[model samples]
Target: MNEAVDEAGWDVEPGDEIEPLVQAVGKLLKVCREAAGLRVAELGEVLGYGEDMIRKMERGARIPRPEYLDRADQVLNAQGHLRAFMKDVERARYPRKVRELAELEGRAVEMLLYSHHNIHGLLQTPEYARALFEMHQPAYAPSEVERGVVARAARKSVFEREPAPTLSFVQEQVTLERPHGGKMVLRRQLEYLLEVGQLRNVVLQVMPTDREEHAGVQGLIEVLKFADGTAIGRSDGAFNGRPVSSPRDLRILELRYGMIRAQALTPRESLAFIERQLGEL
Candidate 1:
């Protein structure tokens, strides 16, 4: 097994201990640069990053983008060790929003999700995730895409958690039809969906375009129910574009998501529907 996978299973809590992981990579980078006898400005010039960005990365305040890591690896002749260290840094500093979801996911007894435009993050394969990120209309640099993909993929850890929370997703049918990553990638994505859907804890429902009234037209929402039966709902634009977790607000979102699920395919039927769509593709 990979060392990273082994560490991920060790119940590594997100806290002060992460500081050392961050610092180690930063220190390694600084040492490599000094050994190369290169100034920060000189290294930045070679990497095409601002000197400040380099400084922040070396200080462990910001995640070094993959391009920076790749260049550092090549320039410092560190072989693949630096690349491995960068992955550890990412596991430490996942985006705030992704981390929030991951924490909630860890505690939730169940989850209800609605995605209108894109595949729900949990269901994405690496290639599909990359294709989705690359489509960022303005286009992301390769490093940006790698960071987003790793963060997104890492969120799937929820599926492997003990007593995994039940997941019910109401995704628009159009999302599957758009073909974001071309035929083969979409095929693999659909296959991955099938594999995940078979997990006892998951429920996936596809919202058809023919629906007369769409509950998700308002946008994406995620509702989580904890062991206490307490629930929280997060909407895309609610709370100034933050997740809405107040009991009252969560109740409202839950009601709406429930309505959306009712309007979509049933879990068993949804699986067949997705398989049929895959066949058509």
Candidate 2:
């Protein structure tokens, strides 16, 4: 038993749609180990994982990290058969909401966003994100925080798409000063905001807290527009906070978002404001 290894990190949540795939992978892993003439404990020793942990993995009760598969493939001499499951496992490890949002973001030609409490996931740096997740009320396990951080970072791929999306962000000024991950993390996040604000496809605006007329007081708002002319939007303040796709419903969210943008600092000015905040740090 490798006492030093942390093998109990990720598990397939009870109702995840990926359960069948994980089960299949788990059965395949067990088959490979048995064919190689190795017992569970023997395989665990070679993999630096515990026998109990190995049982959970073979039973489809846990999600294996990519490195685990890579090492398992080499140890079992399965010739990458085990390694082949890494991509699916990686996707399975992310929360379903993150996966769905990432898919929508991938298809979006434009994204309108307003963040009230924390830095937007797409804009958050990994360190800052990890810090924020670690502060969750129940106190997330270290594994959960890492998974969240990785999922958040993965969504930034939207920024790299060919024919980049027109991303408009309206952030509350308080998000700039909150220091969710401590001062250094906040400083890096501010610096990242400055860097991202320079992108031609992205418009980053900051809403001053002093404004008497604020439309975003309701909560976070997200609107994604697709190339096929369809759009989906959701805001905490409207429609029970459910996603709205009907033109009329989207219009309401859009109207409020337009006002929020109007009340926010201009993109160039927001960048300068962020720079000043960074300097103060």
Candidate 3:
């Protein structure tokens, strides 16, 4: 396993806590495969993965996708035991920072977002997210890109949470215009934005490119408010671009965000703006 890890050129190592869980899952997979009388190559053939990938997964050097586990469960006749680890596998697939952010999002009672660059992670479509990752400067591996797409798409689950969070987003006009994933992807993204904007609990606004009094010139801003009135916020435009949890710092962010909202188009107007962009596409 150490030799494989060294040869694979993995950029990041799994944390101590996560390593054990993945190893346990891998052990179960190996045991199930053996019980089913299937060789690693045979299992790979059945699951559409390579022999090396199957070996890596069994050795816990690779994290399996939920669908992979589901297929493995059926193939190995583990009943539901293998499938039961889907949530853990999914959580492990994401980078630690993303998981932490997702945890905060899950606890948020209200989420306020202002995006000046690209669409917010919670709002991005899978295809769009994939395209963005594909174009990353360092260039993620295909597997890593796929993992990111899935992780980002999973974050949209926040919208479906019961006792739904009050969601608000303010997107810059340029952001809508910039085709991150080509025209077709952009069109779908706009349509999706329009669709999500219609939800009663969501407020989607647009800050036009022509705005002279933009309050969010500092960049992207996000504030997640919890049930107990506590909040966490971060801004690309803020001091050193660090996250802040203090009430005073949060209030400053709130003030800027409020002003940005005021300057942006109303939700209805933003929807119409998006519609126009879709038509132009």
Q: Point to the candidate with the largest TM-score.
A: 2
Give a tens-digit lDDT track for model 2, residues 1-281.
45435644378889889889888888988999999999998988787788887888888988877778888889888988999999989888788899898999999999999999988989999999888888899998777787898889989999999999999999999999998868999999999999999999999999999999999989999999999999999999889999999999999999999999999999989999999999999
* Candidate 2: residue 267 lDDT (0-100): 90
Candidate 2 deviant stretches above 4 angstroms: 1-4, 7-9
Tens digits of per-residue lDDT for model 3 on 63-165?
7777788888998999999999998877887777777889999999999999988988888988889989999989887767866887798788899999999
- TM-scores of all candidate predictions against the true structure: 0.73, 0.96, 0.90
Give the true-structure RMSD of model 3: 4.1
Residue 239 of model 1: what lDDT?
Answer: 61
Instruction: State which candidate has the highest lDDT.
Output: 2
Q: Write the per-residue lDDT of candidate 1 for residues 54-92, one digit (tens) a residue.
A: 676677655564556776889877777688776665556
Q: Give the TM-score of candidate 2.
A: 0.96
Error of 3 at 75 (Å): 3.1
